[model samples]
Target: MADSAPEVPAEERQEDPDVVDRKAEVLAEQIKKSKHFIVFTGAGISTSAGIPDFRGTEGVWTLMAQGRQRPSAVNTLQAVPTATHMALVELQNRGILKYLVSQNCDALHRKSGILPDRISELHGNNNREYYFRAVASYEKTVHDHRTGRKCVRCGGDLLDSIVNFGEYLPAEPLRLARNHAKKTDLCLVLGSSLTVPPASGIPETVGTRKAAKLVICNLQETPLDGLVDQRIYSKADELMTRVMAKLDIPIPQFILRRRLIVQMETTGGSRHQLKICGVDVDGTPMTFLRSIKLDQYCRRAACIEPFTISFRSDLDIGTELKLELEFMGNYGEPNLEIIYSYTGEAGTEMMYLLEYNPQTGEWKTERQESQSVDEDKKPTRRGR
Candidate 1:
């Protein structure tokens, strides 16, 4: 269905370095002077992260049109945020970027530390699923919007959040994006071909305003290139790196952070069961952990949800339990060890925060005790 969309010539272009530098300086000035600055992004911004774009030379649509094999790409779950993604995060941290609108479902922008409230992912996120009454992440692989899981509240079927061909866009994200576009005085377009309507038209709206300025940075010519105030035929990462330097803002490095909630339940007598799983900041089930091992009990739970292990042992009030966690290894992260001490309580819960820096090959861990253990409690669902 994606191949049926409109196509542009697969011609890539790069502007001279000197010209790009000069334009970056001017863009930096515009960012500083503008009151309401916003950004619109597309799949091109993720190409550097091993994700292929739609209209590029080796893009999915381009390959389909040329009768060539589809280009192989890194799994969206394994890919890390690119330089451009991190740069945008830094910009938002400084309050220079008011809002962000993106057509990408890769979830890089959200993983790059951007707040969910500050961005509108118009196309929807691959990692998210929607029920009629709520939206959350699904544990199993979802196909054609069917997650094979029932809604906890209404007993309804859960659906994938991805917007397919002929499907109407989600209303809330579209409303927020249009509102931001109407109020934006400086709109920065990155990695977009400006071909897809609705999502593409948001940037054009800002460009049409008398007091607004629009700048586009992409490797291919966009339909709105001639009308834009500044057009740089360059990679999003390259141009954003220059712009950050001109603005004297340091681009932050990417750090992978995960939270794990561990709970222990007494089956009977000396028998006990321990459960462990990864969770997001907002308590959504995050399936980054591939396997878990309890070395003391010689038990392992891998390739399955509800990672629990049952064992019998005489435990003291302050017994230490060691767990070896094997992650997905997308960023070459090594297996981590978690040392949790038991409180000798039937429903005791412990939280662990793990941070990994791929650049330095370093890891940090923090442990906190939770007061409540509600197994039936569901994460607060959010609407896009």
Candidate 2:
């Protein structure tokens, strides 16, 4: 391969250890001095999460600069939070970080456990689908075939909220960023090369007053390098980990319990035998069952999803089937960075026992107590 090719190497662009540690100390001191620390982020911070940073040697921009084609991008939907992403989450919990202004639309921050009230997404979120009923932070996706991916209620296409290259930044995020920047004492920027657009101007909103300092941590020199109070030439995760260690703070662990639904539609099966299917939260497969339990009269395979079970019975078409369903599960191991990416801090575990009476055609929901830790089971997840 040519030296100019995007795949040139893993060794050519590594960070210098001495420089990384020295830069980390400066930011740690600033973090110690500041009462309010706001954060600004871009695509660079997400590199460790299997997403390419935009301006590094092999980044999207760097490759484009060399007149080379960008590599096949990772599926943004499958992208999870990096170590740096969870480090910020810990800062927020400690109250060291005040607010966030983000340029990337990967939704890792929110998925990393940052709340909508504290952070602003200047660009739109990839996971979000726009509709009239959609709220500001997160939206529950409802599947609709009539309009084909449209909002179930509004009959409008569920638009991916990401703003294109030339599109304007969303007003609410911009406004929140400006408001927070005005009083920020320290602005710690992560991974952003600060080149893009109107979103790039947000950190500048912090005026000269209040002695607001801009501390940027990026591998590459950004356009606003001259304006920064201090520049840390290191990867975000490395520096963030060092800073957290200096502060004697530990990165928070994530514990997640996602909900998936299972529905059945019987078709050509024998009247005595029945078939059931499972579906997940995002409505991927037609039948995605989390767990199944049945009596001696019936059999079930608890190990797999999208599996079919056959049972011989003398029941009518509209008979009420007795079954036990498992609903919640755990996610995100920050140490490994595979499978689950980020877990929420709320940290809850419980199941809702649901009963539907076929004769009455009425549905009822019953609350179940949180399962004992010993009884807790890891659920099988479908999406990447």
Candidate 3:
């Protein structure tokens, strides 16, 4: 008998080997017949924009979960933008992308430069802060170590501007997403493992319902694989390019710029304390370029807030000083750096620069005091 045909390599396998090509063809035909098309995206779509996936072999989430890395190392939406991101922006402009549902808190969907009214961020935006205002700044008048500040409108302690692990999902955005899924005739799932709660259920809800045809494009397989009417195992950028090409959508150019803010709060002995917050554009309150502190100048109990500081004249600098910043988690170790200059007079001012140290858990600072006999009148501390 003749030799059997040689096995095909995994790399050379058909795009959707698990299902017949005719199924996708039929779905596409249905899409053309339908009116409203919605896209439910995951982190997969952002990879083309140079943003790293969170759950792949070398992804941020996997590394952090496995103890090989830290959660703080995850990049923000603006930190990276993939080609697929630009394509989606174009789709939104063309009004073809009726609704976009995302599982990422990185805020990539919003960063694509989409209008807030058009996109629903299921997870809160990382660039902003949120908490019950009543609880955010409650101890302004109290002298206790834990009492920091009180709201002018209502007495409240300021809280960190992020969603904690045990926090409940915001309701309004979830409702909007569900409405989008219901009204959409076509649904696209991009670059998500689809394993997480709430978010994972979204794709299934859209797929099982006869209301929309499900098309999933991811680098890896998801639980929604069997439910998908169309599945493609291609990079988001590549898949988006093909989709846009077929749909005749033009891609836009992306210009990237980075802005950083630093907030230093000091509180300890003698009612001396400082609060520093800055950014290029208006954003949430908890924004900081990098967060670092040392055992010598700072300790966890010295202030009420983790990022707060107690004012000290000894921290002023007259010469260039270096600083290091580290984030929370096991991946980062102590980082070191040299500041070129730190010109300070009264030592009350700080200039901030945005930089990151992959090896540190907090920021490091150096102070140079002025030597001039009469320069003591001015307080000048540049934080970078």
Candidate 4:
């Protein structure tokens, strides 16, 4: 990133109403004519989708500078990508956009369907993994993080990719972004004021050095506006939707894809009861269930993990039984329901991974796992 500069204070500037459409047409033409389009983003691009920018009227830093506390808003854990994110994904999917460089730490770009390798997060991503401070790959016991488990080899802790104040951006992602920015022929700075150092200098570093056109779409003026070829003061979603419409490209809708894997671990005994638990792709536990219907043969008692049943004592382990269970997202982020049906005996123990396909409304089971029972897994735990 370029050296940090004095932060740009937020302000309002209205564009002429008649020139808006003309500017959109110009943008469409620029995009069509350019061979390589690189998109640089900031917090503003996500504001329309519910995340506030850092320098907007209601921006967090703006309010902080005014000697006021930032307003409470929805946390990033629940924030979904906006239309701008989807549009970029479409452009990249069609090969119109070559690369992505983002200063914001929000994980929306990856959530919006961009491949991890195609984009570089200059700041960092929230949904990321970290290695133990001293654990080797082979010695790193891979238990569900939901168990509050520590590294078995060294008892070390993993870390997230969040960069707090006074911390420098990670090196690898920053290098990747700089490489892409330098080679960009057409760069669109979206929803960013370009006030920060290093990153703020990218447009000039790439655009002017390579003789590329710099198109900036933001609500307020930025430090780099004087050098910009086209500056549109507007919301990110509004501007991108119009630009995509002008190009006759439809924004692809993102569908939620979930997976559910249910496993049963039996404690060896004469009358063994298999413990049951299932988790989604994100490691969220499966708790809620759809209405369960029972017949005369299978009499179910109060439902419990691994399912509690009070069938006749004669039908114990080794007796043929059928169990149909429906699991759903606990927090409702994934609203799809998952159904799993097993035709094993009452005490049949096996580790199964069920892939949930929300698009087709079916659960696909995979090959069985040959692992032993884990004593630490709890029904109340959340996945990491």
Scored by TM-score, the top model is 1
User: Model 2, 2: alpha-carbon shift in Å?
Assistant: 22
lDDT of 4 by residue, 100-202 (tens): 9888877778767787678878766655534432232454343222223332223345445555555666677778777877777789999888877666766
TM-score attained by model 2: 0.63
**Where does candidate 2 clash, by residue pair?**
277-287, 278-287, 278-288, 278-289, 279-288
The true-versus-predicted C-alpha distance at residue 59 of model 3, in Å, is 2.0
Which whole-number lDDT from 0 to 100 does residue 268 have in model 4?
39
In model 3, which range of ten residues has the least summed lDDT?
A: 1-10
| Candidate 4 colliding pairs | 1-198, 2-197, 2-198, 2-199, 3-197, 3-198
* Count of backbone collisions within predicted model 1: 0
Q: How close is candidate 4 to the true structure, as a TM-score?
A: 0.67
Sorted by lDDT (best first), the order is: 1, 4, 2, 3
Task: Tell me how candidate 4 scores on lDDT.
Answer: 0.63
Judging by lDDT against the true structure, name the best candidate.
1
List model 1 lDDT by residue over 1-384, tens digit each: 456644565579999999999999999999999899999999999999999998788888877877778857999877989999999999999999999999999989988888878999988898766566344355443235766664433446766678765767888999999999899899999999888878988998988888899999989888887668999988999999999999999999999888898888899999988788677677766667778988777644545666787767767878888898988887888999999787888887899999999888888999996666765886555221
Choose 1 or 2, whichever is better by TM-score: 1
Give one digit per residue, the lDDT tens place, for model 2 in 1-384: 133324432222336887778777778888888888899998888888778876577877567657788777667645657778888888898888889889888878876778767889887776565543333343453222122244322235445566655566778788889888888888988888676768777776653444788877777667777778877777788888888888888886532322323233223443222223332233322222355655444565354544334544333433444555543222211111001111111133234333333234333554344332221343322222
| Residue 49 accuracy (lDDT) in model 4 | 63
Name the regions of candidate 4 deviating beyond 4 angstroms.
1-8, 132-156, 259-384
Q: Output the better candidate (1/3) by lDDT.
A: 1
